[model samples]
Target chain A: MIIANTLADGFVVFLTEAHSWTNDITKGAVAETDEQAESLLTAAKQAEQTNVVIDPYLIPINIEDGLRKPTEYREYIRATGPTVPIPS
Target chain B: MYRYDEFDARLVTERVEQFRRQAQRRLSGELTEDQFKPLRLMNGLYLQLHAYMMRINIPYGALSSKQMRQLAHIARTYDKGYGHFTTRQNIQYNWIQLKNVPDALADLAAVEMHGIQSSGNCIRNTTSDQYAGVARDELEDPRVYCEIIRQWSTLHPEFSFLPRKFKIAVTGSPNDRAAVKLHDIGLRMHQNEQGKTGFEVIVGGGQGRTPFVGKTIRDWLAPEHLLSYLEAILRVYNLDGRRDNKYKARIKILVHQIGTDEFRRLVDTEWQQIKDGALNLPQSEIDRINAYFTPPAYAQIDDETESLNEQRTQNPAFDAWVQANLAEHKVSGYSIVNISLKSPKLPPGDVTAVQMDALADLADEYSFSELRVNHRQNLVLADVPQKDLLSLWTKLIELDLATPNIGLISDIIACPGLDYCALANARSIPLAQEIHQRFQDIDKVHDIGELTINISGCMNACGHHHVGHIGILGVDKRGKEFYQFTLGGSSDQNASLGDRTGKGFPADEAVNAVEKILNTYIMVRNDGERFLETYRRVGMKPFKEALYGSA
Candidate 1:
């Protein structure tokens, strides 16, 4: 599991294969199988390896194109949609 | 004490006009908050939690009575009739309006002061001992070199946009009152075996998430090469210090990651390139700056022992203050008087406009129209006569500025915290106030003896809680305030970061926990042992057990 910390807005998100989680227990998604969740965890770890922690307040966010942007305003990012769109 | 040359004067005047236009543009909706944020910060105006804050520079912590009175005027007219002096020896007005800041800068400039280089990523204020020139043990005045650095660093075109903020502290005496070891560049004046004055340069000392005591980079750097050497270090930092990650951007991390030897080699290589450039100090220029700080024409008088003794016998309150707050001056019959800003009811370093004017009058009457803003957030009249001590004490008493808490627990150093700081997670002033009230007993504080209790509202460590004898850090736990205590930090010759004791305490119980820690120290301390000494001898085991109960 990887946690993303945000500053301008408060709260950290825990990311797992099936879904993103906030506040530890609040789940965001459900994968069809546990194997898919494991692959997601591996991808998150790989993303974390390349990410740079600029301000401690920012959290690493993963885009569908396999790039990560550290940002505090996740809502703005969500509104704009990902730079790399996911496969429909 | 650096007199502004025409170039310096013109630069500040132009800066003031620029900021005036920026403010006007922001008000007229020509500039958005995103556009104006960096511009305002470049000019030392910050939008904090409650109001706009303007930081005014006191270069090398030195101030004249005229400059101080101008500060008083600003406090009276523009702010909430008060100002807070910071650990960097700069004064901050917390309630300033955006419209009023340009005028505030202009007011500051009239007294040969400004807020330039006070914020932003450029080199900030160069601080030094408040007793720089007047201290008995000083090799030479550190302010001369500080002024030299200030002139060179102010808006140096190439080095303005560094990775992180840089701080430099200089001290002339071996006592290290300026806390040089905790600065990005710590310059200490020393006389080598040959009896020549030079600086012992230390680099990479800083506090934050990662606190490291600076390592000595040069054993003896000649006074003439001060600017060249500093420029080399700054240039190296600007190019190599991490810009990718702000957390790893301070020169401290650079020094740590590259290792001191490599960092030193880089600086040496860079210095060789710029050694004899325009930055090299000319002998005539050094002498000119030194002349402004020449010793006053002091009259030879006896130590005024009889009068001092008489006053001590008659007035115990004045006697206690004298013992705690006064320092021996280099001149006979003269002493340095600390006008305490740590009254119980007031914020730790807050001084009202009326009090500032009174202090200005006192400085003129007592100390050759000069004053100093100390890093510990107190004001100093550096040349008060021993005979005039009683009169000054009486006046200070009337003004409610005569708290005899210098170097004591009540003389706590605290940041504005969540009460006023935008970055703060919890409040620090209320905790400081609570601790001050808890240890209000003068005799008890005297018995506790020479403790520095520093509190920071956040991990930025502006209050330097990491180096406090008893450091209190405020953290937010589920939206409620929690306090973490650390023990045995000292910034003097034996510089050491404090050790965390254990689990954090809630806000209401922190004062009692501190009381327990002090009580334990009092019980375990040997004779003549200070608080840091006892904490060092027994370690935090005894303190933790005392505060949290034996387990």
Candidate 2:
């Protein structure tokens, strides 16, 4: 799956089936095979031209029980907000 | 705080208009990301992991109450209702949208603050001792020259773009709270044999992938030759610093590869040409800048204090805050108050808008409507009257800013880490939180006394892990979070970099090492000795032994 953030306001997003960015990773489009992931990336790269989302890139994730989850701790944090609640 | 002059004011306003257009162009797709990246960085707008981050330079760390209140307003209105006071003596709003930053910059400029030179490969903010004017042991107020440098470096045609970013820090005191030796250019004020005040210029020092203590380029430089000499050194670096590799582009790398002696000779050769040129500042200009920093008229205060002493006896908590956070003021009956941002729950250096507003109010009531951002990720009410210390402490406690862990073990200095920074390899805040929880007893922490534990998320060393008495650098080892420890580092005038323990601990077990080390210190320390003193006297051998157990 590929991850990106909306350039308009930095909302966490995942590239979906319609080549659109969504907040839900479960709804994230699966580009399984290497060729498919490459082809999907080609579509994701076009989002940068629209200037809607910034720096769309791939994140290594596993399909764990019907949910897409990041393989690394750091990337998981990028998917969510901070691990701790920020000050009020 | 130094007020902007007509020239300064005009320049900032014009720059704001320029950036507003540029941001609009980028949004309208007139400028591509590649083209706009440098432009945005030059304006202190960074595309961090989460959102656009804006760095606002608080020149020499001084802020008038009015300017600080303006910052609070910005935080509440445009940002995430908070600002992060950085180790560079600047404030960063981490959640800025691209559209809001132009307005944010304009807000900052209205109060004589701007983000210009706060980012990009430029001479960044010139940080100074937070207690610059009020330091009892200070030989001269460093901010006088700090303001002078701020003017000289702002929008300089010659140094608008260098091989890499440059930093300069100034200190007037012998105690070196400014961490001068860690800057690209560190200037320590001193007196010559004739008792003429000048500077001890240390050049080519920085922290990032490579960290080194700056070498003293000139033993002493006369005040008149300051700007000329600095221009010469910068010119040499601009001409010689590597551009091929960003990692090796800093002046520190150039100084190392060519040797400081050779670099000094080259700079001096350039200096000889410009020594008495237009850049040589006249005392008239120096005096004008000095006039801005003249001490506020303080009321006649008693040399010996009774009220504060009685308060200390009556309230132990207030006394603890006084003992841990207050510094000796040059004025006999004044105290420099340090308001710690390292609370038990919040992130270090994070101050909310409400907290900022409260601080502004507190400053008005007690500190002559002035405050300073300390390099240790804290705030300073630099001129609080000794008699008002208790009152200020009470107010601070209500605001949750009264963390009595100033230089103690719980006073951890940490970077935003993986939480906010795009460059971080591991999370720093969680580890810092764990340690703060582990060392929860204030009495024990105060007893541990004056131990600095700095944490960095990566080798960039934004947390200054290299100079911590005990350092924790978070590392990602084969996809798992691990922390590497270092010992015997000090950021004092007598500075020393920490030695790595050659040990790594799991994320949760990192606090175990700290506990064992503190316990060891408790057994071995001599009376009246701080952590670094005991570490220096005993050496890292004992610490290594205590931490890892004979291997």
lDDT of each: 0.83, 0.89
Worst 10 residues of 2 chain B by lDDT: B300-309
**Model 1 spans with C-alpha error above 4 angstroms:** A1-88
- Candidate no. 1 TM-score: 0.86
Model 2 per-residue lDDT tens digits across residues B1-551? 57878999999999999999999998888888889888989988888877788899899899888988999999999988999999999999988888888888898888988888899889999999999999999999999999999999999999998999999999999899999999999999998899988999998777777889899999899999999999999999999999999999999999999998999999999999999989989999999999998899888887446777788899999889988998999998888999999998799999999999989999899988999998999999999888788778888899999999888887889999999999999888888888999998877887888899999999999999999999999899999889999888877799889888876888888999889888888888999888888888887777778887885
Candidate 1: residue A53 Cα off by (Å): 31
Model 2 off-target regions past 4 Å? A63-66
Error of 1 at B136 (Å): 0.7
The candidate maximizing lDDT is: 2
